[model samples]
Target chain A: MLQTLTFFALAGLVTIFALGTLVLRNMFHTFLSFLGCLLSVAGVFFSLQADFIGGVQVIVYAGSVAVLIVLALLLINHKSGDLSRTNLWSHKWLGGVIAAVLVGAALFGVIMFTHFTGLPLTGETAAIEPVPYIELADGLLNQYPVAFEAMAMLLLAALVAAIITTQADDKADKKAE
Target chain B: MEFVNNIFVNIADLCRALFVWLLNLLGLPVGLAEVAMVAVYWLGIVIVCVFCALFYVIWERKLAGYIQRRPGPNRLGPNGWFHTVGDAIKLVMKEDIVPDGADKNVHLLAALLAFVPPMLALAAMPFGEGMTALDLELGVVYIMAVTTLASLPVLCAGYASNNKFAMMGAMRVVNQAISYEVPQALCILSVIMVAGTFNLNQIIDWQTGNIWLVCLQPVAFVVYLITALAECNRAPFDLPEGESELTAGVFTEYSGMRYALFYLAEYCNMFVAAGLATTLFLGGFTGPFLPGWVWFLLKTFVIMSFFIWVRWSFPRIRADHVLTFCWKVLVPLMLANVLVTGVVVYLLA
Candidate 1:
């Protein structure tokens, strides 16, 4: 009963924050809302007993990715005066339609395909034990070694690419000077 | 000795029983008893966090004064014991100022949120034998995750303040936090490799069964200490709020209780870092005589004193040097430490 209530509460929070992210005029406020949304999603994951994934979600998305995005936003929009104007979309309707369609598709897919195992679909409370981290690690490293290694390689490539692009910018600045 | 060691556990059980009994007597659902117990546990942790912050703040000042051959905060009370309490009162009584140009909502929110990361990180930390508040299986990861968000509130404060200094400080915070987190995580990874578990309690158990992890992975221990100092924004890596350059950095525009919250959060983060070091390296709650909780506090205070000593002893490094050192020096060293530890653990297994 408590888990169900907690999950629904978090889901409500996620919805509110996600909407706030889209509806907020100021870019920074939008970012904060987006962060709230991410954290609430992580809370939902935790409610479902996916502790490892929840932790990674917070660490990766809310921690690194969100910070990077905000940093970039601040760098690009140096003037506080322009904060409100920066988040204005040129094609608002198109963007809204695209977002709506994507969300609808995701919802449709989940409703059609995914099985809600051990979840309290009805009003009955279910006891779901958390999956041990060791088994999770074993599955990732042994069962899906290729995918894991590939993901690492992809991240490394992205890092190197970022470094190269920044270096290239520095070189071009020197050339211009 | 055993009873003393398990004093907190016994108290906790007693409280739970009392709560359950009361709920039963009142004809209430027994499930609410667990929720009430959680609230009590949270209250206890809040008390611990506040006291830890207050004690450490005064201790840091006293240590700093001694380092400079002077008495610190001696006027407030005996040995300036009540200095922090007075300061807390003063902070509370002071005028709360929000800059006209600042985002008022974010400015206010930042102060409240600054307390979240450290408090959340504390939830996973094992203070003594069977004294963890949350006791999550992925305690290490949870700590790392929450601590990573420590930069977020600072960033919000900087951006909201509409001050260039605050903005610069926020940028440095993200830079330093992200950079140092690599080495810190890698250091923890090495310990995880040796312990073969992410659970903080199990890690402590592993240390108790064997030897302290510091002896096995000295490099990781040292690296962890350095990165932890950096992670907590302690000198000489305190570039984020470098007073000399940024005039209190992200805290430039904050005043009154809001500023106090930030200050308290910094000390709390330091305490959490020290607690983590004690757990990860100093064989948490393990020692002769005394009790588990006492040993834990002793170890944590020792680590915190070391932190304060380092803060006063060293000069702040350049921002670029800090990042360069983390990536060039600490990261590679920790990666090697992780690799070597992994290989050794595999062989032993």
Candidate 2:
């Protein structure tokens, strides 16, 4: 009973902050409110028994990464302090309404039949005894080695791209100097 | 991997038993034991965080000082042990100043925000057998998910500061975070695949007979560690808070206690990252002769010390260089590593 109440409370907090994110006039405030919404969403994740992913949501979403985004945003000096993108919201409200309607319809379609029968365990409480984390590690490295190789390449690519982007700016700054 | 999962499942059974017993007992009466346990859990987290942050700060400074061949905080406590504590006190006592035009509440919240998520993530970390704070059935998943909350507060601090450097740092964070997150998750999945379970306790258990996953998944371990460093924004990749350029990056406008919180959060983050890496790759709490908690602490600290060493040794890479290194260098390497692992595993089986 208490768990359900906490879930609702957290979900409500998320909704409220999300609404605030949209309604706030200040662009920065919007981001700030969105952070609040994200944190509460993490709370919802916790309520749903997905603690590991929830922690990632907090650290990756709320920690260094989001800070880096805001830090990037702060680097660009604006022409004015006013964050109001006049007429943009008014024009987009209909689009939002249409999106909301579509989303609601989709949710309505799925709410009635919560289970796709014959599927594996669906209940959050339906116990699947946790296999150890190392088994997963072994499976990756020794068992499913090809996928591991592919993942390495992916990270390498991300690194290269990040370096190139930052290095170009460094060159520009140095050239200016 | 099978053994690890079995162990975690067994441990979970015991935890459920204990919790059920406690709940049953609690249903009838309220005891100080419950409160003490709760306090111990949270307090353990807090004190450990405080000590980790404290030691990391002082340790980093001393390291930096040593590398630079200059004296660092030698006067506070012997070898400057109390330097961070003094600094903490000083920051706490300083005036809390809010910018006149900035939204006060958002700015205020941003300071405290970065500190919480890491602690929450810490809740599910397995310490040897049956020694963890909230053993989620989905322990590994829980740690990963809870950590996602941490990125937002960074963005919050940046935007609320109304500073250009902070904003740029925040934007880079968002972009880099999303990009790197994919690989981190994938690499983590590789570990999960081996164990056939997401529970961290199970992962640890899988290695009880001295079967550390690092021997088998060395490539995955390396990729994950590199990504973890980048994920934590350490050293060469720490563009967001690059001292030379950003003047403290997202934390520029923060002052006094707010700055302190960000500072504390930074070290806690570093510790958390190291802790997770140790848990995932280095056989969390699986050492000989020591208690589980001690083994866990020792391993995590050893990893933490390594990060500190690397930070002091390496020169800060350019902002673009940091990103490119991850994408072009780290990502591709990890991907190829994953592919090789997959193919080999299939053939062997």
Candidate 3:
């Protein structure tokens, strides 16, 4: 009973922060709310007993991604006056509505597809470890080695592409000079 | 020694037993009480972390003063033991300052973001065998991830301050943290491959009287030490709060308890980094005579003092140089260490 309550509380917090991220006028507040949402989602992960996932969410998303977003904003959009009245949804309400509908559809599809055997599982079902991260290493390294290798190859390609683009930009600047 | 070790280990079980007994007396099922008991365990951990932070700050100050050939905090209480206590009082009593045009909510939230990560990181850190708060399977990863979250608060504090120096400090910190994490993670991965598990206690067990990983994985140890220093934002890597140049860095606009909280987090982070280096490299909680927790504390403090020594003795490098060293030098070295360790472990296994 207590677990369920804590779960709802964290889920509600995530919902509130997610809405705040989208609804806030100021970009800075939007970023803060986004971080809050990310953290609350981590909290939800913790409540689900997926502690490893929770930690990764906070470390990668809340820590790196959110901080980078705010830092980029601070550097690129230094003047507060310039962002006082950002018309983010001025002419893109249709696009916003479409995105919202798509998200809703995806959520509905997930709810419909995934099996949710409501709480108080029988002995056999409840006996499972209730965590998936324990087998993630083996699954990634052995069971899905090809997929993992592909992902690594993609990352390496991206790294090479980034270096090439930056070097090319330097060359272009030198030539122009 | 056994008695002392059990005292720390039983704290969690004691809480559960006491709560279960009370819940039973109240004619309630003790099932839900387990969740509350977990909360009690966390409360204990947080309390211990705060006290440790206080003492560690004093020790760091005294150590730094000694290194500089100066008397450290002699006026507070008997060799300045109560110096941190006095600082705490002063901080609490001081006026809270919010710079004009600062983001009020984020300014307030920044302290919380800074303070919470180190405390949470404590949950995964084992003081002795079975002496962790959470004991998650991926204990090492959990600690690394939670500590990484600390950069967000630094970013928040800098951005919310609306000061250029604070922003610059935050930028430096974000870059330093993210860049160093790659090498740090690689170093840790090398250790994990050798230990063959992410459970910190299990890893320590691998080294109990056998051989400390520092002997087997000397290169990883060096990489881990350097990256750990960078990760914790300790000297040479403390460009985030570069006082000489950036003028107090991210906490430039912060005052009173808010500023103190950031420092508290910093000190606690130092302990966490030291504790991690101890657990991963030095055999954690393993010694000849004293209790496990005692050995753990001794090793962690020794590592932390080394960091303090380096902080005071070494000059801070330029920001670009720091990044270049991480990306160009440390990353390749760590990657090589990881590959070598993996091959050796595979052959031995």
Candidate 4:
């Protein structure tokens, strides 16, 4: 009973945070809202007994990536006037409608295809030991060793690219001065 | 032979009766005793998080003081043992400042983003046999994924403050963060060669009772520990908060309670990095006799103390220099370490 309540409460919070992320005017605040949504999603993962994935969600999505985005925004130092998401083309409402439709479709598909039909599981059907989420790691290393190594290589490239881009920008600025 | 069989049967009956008695006394219906068991398991987890957060702060302060040739805080209860508690109360009571034009909601939320990841990371960390909050199969990956949360709030703090310095600081941090994560995760995958499981408890078991991964995997340990320092953004790697230039970086605009929360999270994240280093490389609570949790805590505190020492003693490396070093040195070295661990594990197999 308590678990059901906790899950719904977290789901609601995620929705609120997601809304905040989209609608909040301040870029920084939007980032924070995104984080709140990520965290609540992590909570949902925990309730699903996907403990490892939950932790990763909290660490990677919430901790590193979200923070990185916010930090990236910070680097730009645009005034609210500078990037007032208000200046975008007039098709914003259409974009919103499309986003809403896509979300609804995704939800409907999950309900139709997944075991997550409206009803909660009875304890009898709640087969206890969680199916391993860690299979992703195994599948990554053993069956997909090339892909795994490639991710490492890609990250290496990201580092080099990030550095080269920043240094190039600095050099250009120096030349302009 | 009948007498011996009856003796075994009687022992089995006693065990069954005892189990029923235990269930009845546990405030659970007979069918839900396992749920009750889970509650008890998490109570221990709550205690570990609270205790570590509270004391680890004070310990870091002391270590910081010692390295700087000063007594950290000796006047509070018993060699300043309760100083952090006092600080907590002061922080809770402090009138938190929300700057004009600041989005109050995001301003508060930024601190939370910073605060949460370390707590989540702790759950996946394993101690001794049968000790952990929840061992998901993808423990290491989960931890790696959640580490992204640790940097978001800084960016939030910077942007929400409407300060250019904060923005510059956040940018510096973003660069540092993704750079370090690569080496850190690769190094851990190196160890995955031997353990064959992302479940931390299983990884520990693979390390314990004779074949500790650290002995076999020294380079991974070194690379992992260094990358962890960088990932945590501790000194030399702490370009985001470069006080000399950026004036505390993303945290410059924060004050009072909001500031305190971000401050606590930074120290706590250091503890997370240290704890992880302990688990992945240092035999992770595998020692003779002394309780496993005790060893885990002791090792973590030791690692944290080392970090604090280095933070104070070393000069902050330049931001560009940090980027150059991670790419030029740490990445290639750690990737090679991963290859070596995998090949060695295969050869032994």
Candidate 5:
């Protein structure tokens, strides 16, 4: 009963924050809402006893990714007057179409792939045993090596692209000077 | 000896029994009773953390004064023990200021959120034998995850302050934090590889059964210390708040109680870091004569003193140098350490 209540509470929070992320005018406020969304999603995972995934969610999304987004925001040189205008509704129809399609696809994936289990109305289900980290590691490295390596390569490519882009900008500035 | 070792465990059990009995008398459900116990545990942790932060601040000042050949805050109480108490009162009584053009809500929120990560990290920390608050299986990962969010509040403060210096400090914080975390995670990974568990308690048990990880994995221990110092934004790695350059950095616009929250969080972060070090490397809560809690605190204080010593002894490095050193020197070293540990573990298995 408590777990169910906790899950619904976190899910509600996640929905509110996710909406705030989209609707908030201020970019910084929007980012904070997005962070809130990510953290609440992690809370949901923790509620489900997916401790490792929940931790990784906080680490990757709320920690590294959010900071990266903020850094990018800070890097953009904008006057105080332009601050509020940054997140104004531009290309609204296109954005709406894209968002709708993305959400539809996610819903479709969930409906198609997820296995839903019915819970008892009263009392508690037996406590779920946590998967050990070693088995988790083995599953990633051995059972899903291709996916793991592909992710690693994708990240490496992104890192290299970032470095190259910055280097090129530096060279361009030198030439202009 | 057994009784001494289980002292905290006994106390905790007594509290839990009393709490459950009271809840039963109130006709609360079993599940609600358990939830209430968790809340009680969190309350206990918060109280302990606040007192720990207060103690650490005064301790850091006294140690700094000693290092610099001066008496620090000796006027208030014996060896200025009540200095932090007075400071806390003064901070509370002072005016809370939010800068003009600042994001008022975020400015306020940042101060409150600054305390969250450290407190969350503390939840996983096994203070003594069988004394962890949460005791998650993924304790190491959970600590890493929460501590990673430590940069967020500073970033929010910087952004909301509407100050260029604060923004710059925030940028440096993100850069430094993300960079140091790689090595820190890797260091923890090496310990995890050796101990064969992510559970902090199991790791401590492994250490008790064998030798402390510090002796087994000395390289990882040293690297972990450096990364931990960097992680906590202690001096020599405190470019985020380099007072000489950024005038208190992300904290440029903060004052009074809000600033005190950040200050308290910083010491608490240090305490968590030191606590992790004691658990992972210093044979947590396991010593000959002293009780487990006493040993844990003793080891933790030793590590905290080392952090303070290093802070006062060294000068801060340049921002670029800090990043370059992390990526070029620390990352590769930690990677190699992990590789070596993996091979050793495989061989031993």
Candidate 6:
């Protein structure tokens, strides 16, 4: 009962905020609404009892990523776009239709799988107790060391790529001078 | 250990059990009782925040006065014990002003964003054995994550106010707070590697009858202290709120209750930082010959006073120096400490 209530509450919040992000006219307000969407999704993770992932969601996604987005927005210093040109059946109509169809297909897939497989209607996937954090760490480090190493390597590569691009931009500016 | 077990731990548990029993007797559903427990837990944390702010604000002033050889707030009650409460009332009575150009909703939300995170972080703070409001398994990570939210309100207040100084201060705060967090997290990782758990209670438990992590990882201790000072925006790391340059910085346009909430949050953040330092390094609530809670308070105050003293004594660092020092010096030092500590812990085990 508690899980269902939490799911509905958080799901409603997520939907509202996601729509707010799309509907808001002001750019900064849109960013704030997007942050609300991210946080409500984190709440969904918490309600699902994936505490570790929920925490990482807050720390990594809502905290760092959202701040980075705001900072990027600040750098551009752009305000609200012109609302006069937002006709629904204009040049972007195909993009909207395709996005809606994609979302509908995903939803249909989820509903069909759950209905046909006799799975729980609620969001939880399994009844087993959560693997303790220690065991999770142990499994990652010992059992799936290669996967862990690959993840770390991917992050390192991203860092290096970012530094290289910034350096290249600086050198190009120097050359232009 | 005996002192700790016999004091607030038992009392806290007994009070909780009694509350649960009373709710059950009143024919409340178990779920309602659980919700009530969580509510009481958060309420207790907020009460602690207010209580800490009340005492620590005055304590900070009194200590500052003594260090500077002057009396501080000696008029209200005995030695101005009521000064903070009086100031709080004054703040409540004062008119709240939002600048004409301010984004009203964002400004309001900024004050709340600034105020709530420190209180939330306090929920993980352990006063004594079993005395935490919520003893989650990932207490350390939870504290770090919640405390990171502190920077957001500064950003919001800066942007929403549409003020130049506020904007500059907010930008500086983002850089300082985010950069210092790296060293802070690394320092915490060293302690976690040693204690082998993220639970604050379990970390303290590991320190019982053992040398505290400070002794084991002194470099990390120093790094943690510096980063913590930076984290709380206390001087000499308080460049973001530099009075000489920015005139109260991100809170330049704030007034009355909004200002008071910011003030309360700052002091509460100080208490939280000092409490964390004490727990991780000084072996929280573990001392000879005193009640556990009293010892905890004493150690926490000692660390807090050190912060106050440093704030009074040192000049503020330059804005550029703040980021450079953390990234170039503290981060590397903390990284090395964590690496060495990991090796040592592994060898010993």
Give the alpha carbon lDDT tens digit for every residue of B1-349 in model 3: 5788778667777778888899999999889677787788788778877987899899888998998999977887798889999999999999999988898988998987787888888888888877787877878878888888878888888888989899889888899999998998898988888888888999999988468999988888888888888888888888999999999999899999999999888888888889999999999988888888899999998998898889889999889999999999999998888888878888998
lDDT of 5 by residue, B82-119 (tens): 99999999999999999888989999999999999999
Each prediction's TM-score versus the true structure = 0.94, 0.76, 0.90, 0.76, 0.94, 0.89
Across residues B279-315, which tens digit of lDDT does each residue of candidate 1 receive? 9998998888888889989999988898999999999
lDDT (C-alpha) at residue A21 in model 3: 75
The residue pairs in collision within model 3 are none
User: Model 3 segments beyond 4 Å from truth?
Assistant: A81-88, A97-128, A131-135, A153-177, B10-14
Query: Model 3 over residues A29-95: C-alpha lDDT tens digits?
Result: 8887888899899887776667778878987898778877777676677567244344353566777
True-structure Cα RMSD, model 4: 7.1
Candidate order (lDDT): 1, 5, 3, 6, 4, 2
What TM-score, to 2 decimal places, does chain A of model 4 have? 0.70
Q: Whose TM-score is higher: candidate 3's or candidate 5's? A: 5
lDDT of 5 at A12: 92
Please give the distance, in angstroms, between residue B132's alpha carbon in candidate 4 and its true position after superposition.
1.2
Residues forming the 10-long window of minimal summed lDDT in candidate 2 chain A: A117-126
Colliding pairs, model 6: none
Clashing pairs in 5: none
Point out where model 5 deviates above 4 Å.
Answer: A81-88, A118-132, A162-177, B1-4
Location of the lowest summed lDDT over 10 successive residues in candidate 2 chain B = B28-37
The TM-score of candidate 3 is: 0.90
lDDT of each: 0.89, 0.73, 0.84, 0.73, 0.88, 0.83
Candidate rank order under TM-score: 1, 5, 3, 6, 4, 2
lDDT tens digits, residues A1-177, model 6?
Answer: 566676788889999988877777665677678888988987876665566777778788777788887787676664533222343324677778898899999999988788342112444545625437788888999999999999999999999999999899999999999
Count steric clashes of candidate 6: 0
User: Native-vs-model 1 lDDT?
Assistant: 0.89
Sorted on DockQ, highest at the top, how do the candidates line up? 1, 5, 3, 6, 4, 2
How high a TM-score does candidate 2 get? 0.76
